[model samples]
Target chain A: MNIANKANRLTPYVFMAPAAIILAVALLYPIGYMIYASFLDWSPSQRIGEADFVGLRNYVNLMHDAAFRESFWVTVKFAAVVVTLEMFIGVGLALLLDRNIKGMSFLRTIFILPMMIAPIVVGLMWRYMYHPTVGIFNRTLKDWGFEGIPWLSDSTWAFVAVVMADVWQWTPFIFILSLAAMQSLPRSALEAAEIDGASDMQKVIHIKLPLMLPVLIVTLMLRLIDAFKVLEVIMVLTNGGPGLSTEIVAMRIFRTAQEFQELGEAAAMSNTLLMVLMALTIGMFAYNKMQEGRAAKMQAMAAKGTA
Target chain B: MPKIVLEGLVKRYGSFEVLHGIDLEMEEDEFTVFVGPSGCGKSTTLRMIAGLESVTEGEIYIDGKPVSQLEPKARDLAMVFQDYALYPHMNVAKNMSFALRLQRMPKAEIDAKISAVAETLGLTDFLHRKPGELSGGQRQRVAMGRALTRDSSTFLFDEPLSNLDAKLRGQMRAELALMSQRVKKNMIYVTHDQIEAMTLADRIVVMNGGYIQQQGSPEELFKNPANKFVAGFLGMPPMNFLDGEITEKSGEIFVQGQGFSVKLSHQKAEAARAHSGRSVTLGVRPSDLVYDPAAAEDQSLLVSIIVSEYIGAQTVLLCDCGGQKVEVELKSTIPIDRNGQLRFAINPEGVHLFDKKTEIAL
Candidate 1:
């Protein structure tokens, strides 16, 4: 009986052993190596073991470096602006297009094509569109007899251009999720709202939006985390711009290690970005767990009441 | 109170017609029940009256004003759906006060109304609980409370108690009947259950195949059904139908079938005389057949017991009359010989005859 009990206890761990080994090797090993390297004065030219030990020097330098501070601020601003715009446009479009119309499935397929494109391809496509002389916007402006605006040359315009591109590529992610959430809503409640004298706007505000909130919040968080780590699209569009205006943290880390040969500083910058994203992921998980716990508690209470 | 009149109301999906031009008029503050089997368009008719469904080619008038094109809220009605349709995110109080709040009633007034209705529904203690935390019976009560709080002139119920267990359904049915009396709003209820229609309705409209079969008071419908379907559709231990031919012998009418022949009463015989020598269906209620050993041969049936189901106060026996099966509800105290055949006297007043071809009453 004791042997049987031991075997039962070991069963789950035995099944989990392979995944645990893969996680340690593929995920933890790289993260651990990066953390260790963040404290050393390492360069790509030298072996890691031969690098001089420097505790907290890279982090201390990051604090006072004006370039690093500017990039960090820019990353935060870009994520905030892009994610907010995407959420509004995406959720609004979902609400507007939820009903049946001719060729709706084909239209939805066209709407989501941008998100399905490769990031590199998206960057190249936007690069051509944002071209000052030959781009669609400038050509349309020239035809309409308006002065062509600088899209990617000036620092401020470059930032705006990158934000627009990111929005274009990611808004469909939010749109599809919000649409699925809207479709799965209990339809009878909306009918009840109609009988309760609610107009179209009132029904949307009172019934539909509130019920779709949980899924929307989680979708928004997932997009926020993705926006923080964005790199390829901005690289092809602006490459940190004429100045350091659109230089987000990921680009800064790339340039720090590749062009400047400061692997330690790049590792430190990557760690900071990773920490911010970890907090967001953890928040999303915590929210999901809370929702599940409340649902279970409500069910348990109801079951007890009935019993 | 408003009177509702449906003049040639019809419903169609694409080109396929579901309701073929229904016409009905409900009086002020009347409790009307539309009862039928599934797909009989009873709920569809109620929904059309509530303005949840679009009228295909006719008009619905509320208090003499046309309301076919109006929105549901504009029609001044509230409906409890079959699934209750309670807002799952809202507490009982909020759900009840939703329509009131939409009208912009004062907060205090809304609260007082909600509290009063909640108290009546026995949901006062559960005002703060969301629908997810409530049991099935509690949710049903909240649904009722929501409608009561609306204070609309007309109320619609679509199988509200169909979701509850048998015991809770009985309890709620009693409550609904009592509440319908205390509150005199025009109520239209739809259900497939005949017992509910019989017990709660001032006027029961029997529907089949999207057409109104018959509509009348419970007693009128039970005693004199318009057709064979309505007779079979209503009543517990449903009315038994036996195929027979009406024959006239010396100014007397008799309906003779496979194993028994029954003499018609004077009034029914006069009605059947015109259709003499014609095939007809003989209808008798299970309660009309009483155990009587010495009844006259023409006014009684002899049957052999096949299956006896004993309830508390009655025994429902499924007996064989020749090749056809006939059920008789008997008092459990009556002694029975297990092997011998039994005879039951037929109540002449309970006799119903319908034309075989049209299935209409003779």
Candidate 2:
């Protein structure tokens, strides 16, 4: 090939080189360093040259650590519970507010306000609200002739409080996505359903929900991933609580490296969390690929039928 | 079978009225078609009857029962929309059986109905495929199958074939006609295509500007249109119109225009004499202009042929008659030179006269 032809082919890669280089430095380098460090018996007070190569000892030690295991279980439980609640409430609110009314834009804007605040600020705000004595919730209960309830002081109540805060901050993410999916639905299909003897509830159950499934599934996966890695809110509110009740994996990792001074163990825990998230990402992509394959098969069948 | 009636049907969007007091009566088991251009209130009238759109100031009675205030499900009617409107996520069988499932019918009966409809529409093999997986034509069939499974007393179609390609549209149009004949229901179809109206309608209602211009059998409307709009809208290639003045020469009434003058028929002469010396518009169809070399001077049009489009059996000629344009359709074998003058005899009975100012038939 001529030099001009070679240059023409290489031009696109030259234009893309800056972004590729930035990604390598900003993303891949840290992950590679973390993987290497997870195999070392290192402490924050020691230099890298003085650290010993442990070779999977930290990972082996994590399997027997009850605290780490408890934190992992707590993260799984929190993600499952909060994401389930958020999906239902968010989709329900989207359905209720999908129509046009006066000041609807303002109402939608106000609905998503919690998602816009910084996570630490949201945690602080909820912590004040869940205060055992002086919080607005306890104050309102006392005003209603009820005794002040233990909110953040009790382990069970602390879990509930943290879950509520997470739901409040993240439900809007699902709500906006669900609302967009609902609005983009084929209008004529709903009208046809109405004419086909479908009542309002039946229309929602049969037509609307089924059509919004793809968007809902993707949104649920995203929320689950976010919920697994949640830290700041629980850190500011309960600090892992009276027991390990509110100790999610992310918070446990932070406390391990800072409070326990075990950098190697923390790195090992983070690697485990990273593997779990990678599996979830792969599962999501597999599901999307399967759906695409089925669609392509149907299109082929339809084309054959026409031919 | 049910008889449908609309009394003082009015539809308004805010302050602008779209349907102005439409009153129509459809007979039992009749295939009535409402045809007009877009924004002419035909689809609005059909939608109001389907209960998709609320009637502004009207009462719709089906089988002598008022149903204007009822929900669409309360009224026993099924509608096919311009878009196919199939459930994108549901399989073809599930989409078709949704109504039966909603009614809480026996599972066996629902399955039977779905299978029968699927077989009829040739969708049996695609019963498990979602609408998004299907082609446009298959989706259209699914939409039809969904409505057919309902077995409603009335069937409403709002330009259901408008989205299909030309060939597929013709195929679907034939199938629709066959289905309508086999299942005799009170079918009301709305479309802007006049050919669909002429082929599928037991009675064609031509509307314009929110008003019913004329309603009659296809042959009746084609033979004698009530006004100029009705005359021009109901025919293929459309009717050509030329402005002329009605003049009396030697005690005979004649319609005189730029490049042609023809003696009026005896029946038309009486109508022309009453408006002599007044301006009028002459309406003629392309098929009515015959190619004749020895035609009398007073009975023919002298036209300069500009373009000839050949379509297998027939050729459509675009010709200029003085300053006015007219189309002439003839057999392709007949030789004709482009940009040359030609004479075509006018079929006397095919001529129609309308008042220039009012555009109403004289």
Candidate 3:
């Protein structure tokens, strides 16, 4: 009987062993290798064992390098601006379209089409649209008797062009999630608010937005994480040009490994980006836990009161 | 208090009409209940009056002003929904004080009103809890408290107690009666439960198939239902309906059915003489049938017992009067053997006759 009891306790771990082994081999091993490789001076021409050991030299060099600092600032700015714009536009569109008009389902399907396209495909599509004189934007400008402006040749215009493209691609994700959230809200509460003498603006400000905060917060975090790792579209557009003005950190890390041939430095840059995303994910989980804890405590007090 | 009136009110969804030209007048501080079956448009009428539904072809007047085109907030009324639509995120106090805060009332006055309403409803102890944290009964009280604190000229309840258990519903029904008496406001309630209508209504408007069948005081409606549907809808265990024919035999009026023949009283005979040899229906309440073995033949019915349901204080027996089923409410002490026939004497005053074709009282 004692042996049977021990076997019963070990059953769950025995079942979980295969998944744990696959995770170690597929995911954790590469990450561990990257962290170790960040501390060496290495190149693609030599094996990892032949590389010289360097203690924190790559990180110190990154702090003093102006180009690296500029790329890091650009990445931060790009994520902040794109996430904010996507949230506002997405939530606004959801509110505007939450009614039973004719062909509403068809309109909603078209709205989410931008999000379903492949990222590389979206980059290619926008690259054609932003072409210098042959592009639709410049052609329309010239047809209206105005001078055709450079879309990708100027540094400031390239940054603006990339931000607009990112916004166009990702805003639909927030819109769909928020529309589902709005539809699932307690409908009777909204009717009650209408009977409570609330105006149109007041109802949206007080009831609709406050109730949608949880889904909105998680959507913001997800979009921010995706924004930091953006590289495909910018790579196809200007290749980090007009002289490094739009070189986001991900593109810089790619160039460092492929073009500059500094494999160890590139690994260090990737590690830094990973840490920032980790902090954001942890903050989201902590907020969710705090909400759940408060709910559970209220339930306990209610049970005690009833008892 | 306001005198509310619905004049020729009509509601339609696209081409299909729901309420057919309803006309009603509620005096100051009257508790009127609209009772009907499902799809009977009782709730639709209440919602039209509350401005939640648009009136397609009529006018609603509050204190003698046409207000059908107005918004719900501009109607100056409070409503308690069937689902207890309390805000899930707001605490009990905030949910109750939401309307007052929107009006921009003084903070001190709002606090005082919230406390007073909460204390009356026995919700003071759970003032800080959200709707999710409270039990079902407490959430119901909070919904009531929210309506009470609004101080509107009228209060509307749309089947508020139908969601509670049987025991809790009885308790809340009594509390609603007491509250209606305490607060002298024009109250309109809607429910499918006849017992709730009979207990809480000063005037009951019985509806069926999107039309008002009858409207009167409970005692008047019970004694004299305008039609057969009203008669069957407003009583517990329902009034028994038996098909019969009116006949004149030896200068007396009689209604004869399959298994039995009953003589009418002098007053009823005189009134029923005009419709002699006409097909008719006999309506009798279960309470009017007494278990009397020595009753006269023309005044009683002989039936074979089928099932005896043993409820405390009374035993309800399901019996067959010839080919039709009939129910009788009997005292538990009545010596009734399981397999034999029994005689139930009918009260002459309790016999209700209706025209077979029209289903209207004769």
Candidate 4:
């Protein structure tokens, strides 16, 4: 190639080199290591190079393991329930608070305070609050002449307790994003909707929610992905106890590798979780691309019409 | 046949009042336009009427019924916004039929209304397209169509054509004028464009500094402006003001200033004689100045042409009259050269005098 042609070809890559290098170090390397380690029967006591090549043994064992399967189902159920609840409550709160009242800024700050705390701290706090004998909730119920219910001891109550903790800590993530989306919506459109004779409920259902769908979809996907990998708070509070009711996949993988010392099996479980998250991420990207394409098509049509 | 009345309407933000005690009445089926520069509270007044902005201190009556506390939906009005404000997620047909559907009208009636408006707006071919797919002009038409489909007692337009390009804005303005004539509803439009105000309004309410300067028919506001601001704001090239003193020259009244002096007409002189020796502003439209070489000295201005802009049939000459810059519009066929000194006679009837301090027309 001529020097000019070579320089032109090199220009794009020159500008892209930093991102490429960072992607290799930050993404490709860890995934590559995990894949290689998943094929070996490794242990915490042995060097990865010294480990035996076990081929499909770990995968075959994972398929038969009842505990792993239970934990996988538990993770899916937890993610589904928590994300659904959080989306409803969060978007509802955003709608109710999306106004210009005094102290709104202060209220918004307070609403998001739970999301900013450390997950471990959140777990500890909620654990104390869920105490059946002496917690504020039970005390209040007792004062109201109600029975003190077992919050964390019974299997069903333990699941509910963990789900409540997760919801409390993460609903704010959806709230802030939904609020920002609501605030940035075209003000003129809302005003036009008002003048078009749409009632308040109709505006919320037909205009606000549909207009906020794109942002809400992305937010839901992000929260669902994060929910699948949740472990810290569940670990600190229930520790996957009360008959495996709160044993999410991340906790399962941690216990598999650390408690059982089965690094290969844990790697297999991690790979499965990674694949689920990858599918979700790909779905989100595809949705965003479709939205952008639709927008561009509309603009082109509008231009042609005007022209 | 709703006659809208705004009585003692005021808007305030905390302690700062933006619209103070505005009282106005619109007869049934009148096209009223609110026009002013930015921050003149024209939009605020329109929003209050639409019930989008709360009336801080007073009441609005429609057909003699108090409706200040009513919601916008209950007020029986439709608005076309500046940005077109089409629902981005809905197709044009659905957008136009939203209000009808909300009212739970029959499906057949809703379909008929949608198709009728769509056909009128020439949007039938693009009925299935979402707003994001339409051009600015098409979106503007859809906004109009949406309002038309509602068939409300009143229609409000808040600078609906301001978002379109210059050519598109002109085209849409013509279309809006035609639509307004066809519909004959009680319409209140707001715009900062003087041309829009002049061409579209049955009555133009010119506002400034959060106050209504003048309100009258377009011709009345153009020919007999109550203030210098209205005079300058209503014309195409704008009226020019020359700082001059009202002087009594040989028992006749003349406005003499830096570059030229012109004898006031009998009526103008009578008005100016009351303020003799007081500094005043001489207002003259560009169209009022005609090129004349043999005109009398006090009736004509000797100006040196600095720049001549030829716009097809009419040419605008920027001339220096003494130290003041004055513009004169003449036939493009007139032979004029740069740096040439020329005399242009002022029409006696076109002369306007204003108090220099208050800018009120005399």
Q: In candidate 2, what are the lDDT values of residues A4-93, reduced to their tens digit?
A: 999999999999999999999998998887888899888999986678899999999999999999999999999999999999999999
Residue-level lDDT of model 2, residues B106-211, one tens digit each, is 9999999999999999999899988877888988999999999999999999899999999999999999999998998989999999999999999999998998
lDDT string, candidate 1, A144-182, tens digits = 999887998988889999999999999999999999999
* Winner of 1 and 2 under DockQ: 1
| Candidate 4 per-residue lDDT over residues B56-114, each given as its tens digit | 99899999999989999888999999888888889999999998888899999999989
Candidate scoring better on TM-score of 1 and 4 = 1
Candidate 3, residue B111: the lDDT equals 92
Q: Over the stretch A33-76, how does candidate 4's per-residue lDDT look in tens digits?
A: 88888898999999999999999888899899999899999999
Which DockQ value does candidate 3 get? 0.55
Candidate 1: fraction of native contacts reproduced: 0.66
Candidate 2 Cα lDDT to native: 0.91
Docking class of 3: medium
Considering summed lDDT, which 10 consecutive residues are worst modelled in model 4 chain A? A298-307
Report the candidate with higher TM-score, 2 versus 3: 2
Q: B-chain TM-score, every candidate?
A: 0.99, 0.97, 0.98, 0.97
Candidate 1 clashing pairs, residues 3+ apart or interchain: none
lDDT of 3 by residue, A5-99 (tens): 99999999999999999999998999998888888899999999998889798888888879889999999999999999999999999999988
* Candidate 3 lDDT over residue span B145-241, tens digit each: 9999999999999999999889889999999999999999989999999999999999999998888999999998998988899999988889988
In model 1, how large is the Cα lDDT of residue B291? 89
How far does residue B239 in candidate 2 sit from its true spot (Å)? 0.8
